[model samples]
Target: MMNPAPALPRLAIHYCTGCRWLMRAAWMAQELLTTFEKELGEVALVPGHGGVFRILCDDELLWDRKIDGGFPDIKALKQRVRDRIAPGKALGHSETAAH
Candidate 1:
């Protein structure tokens, strides 16, 4: 049987106080998008009204919630990113759980 196609992913970045953090986050998110494009396909990271945001698999509420550690928390952000790239699988699933 043919499997259903995975839904398109979406990202939303809530507006924060300054552009420094948001800008950095946006850049990092873009890098992630490029890396995951082969698997998860295209992804988006946008700014909203309170903080930065990113699409989880297809969730658009990532921006609504505050992200801990801010921009420096690339590890945490990457985890959330990996979650979207390979929902059930771990980051770099082919190898160890962590990548």
Candidate 2:
């Protein structure tokens, strides 16, 4: 018998509802979904407070706004997610952009 395909990774974006960051979270979700449609199984927006903003892949922390000192631009975010899910994968122009 043939083995089934592995389950794709799940990403969660926890944004501060009190801070009104839902739109930002939603946009990030859309971006990740568009970029990693095949690699990612789902992108969930998790409501949070206390100025929280974080991205996680299968419970692995990818980005933490406070800990990281600031929010990552989409290019950096994509690099972070890609490093977690598909290391060494090409990110086209994002790869060439300065860090």
Task: Give the alpha carbon lDDT tens digit for every residue of 45-73 in model 1.
Answer: 45554454433446534332344333434
What lDDT tens digits, residue by residue, belong to model 2 across residues 1-99? 999999999999999999999999999999999889889999999999999999999999999999999888999999989989999688888879566
Most lDDT-accurate candidate: 2
Worst 10 residues of 2 by lDDT: 90-99
TM-score of 1: 0.51
Which one is best on TM-score?
2
Show model 2 residue runs off by greater than 4 Å. Answer: none
Steric overlap count per candidate: 11, 0
What TM-score fits each model?
0.51, 0.92
- Residue 48 in candidate 1 has what lDDT? 51
Model 2 Cα displacement at 4 (Å)? Answer: 2.9
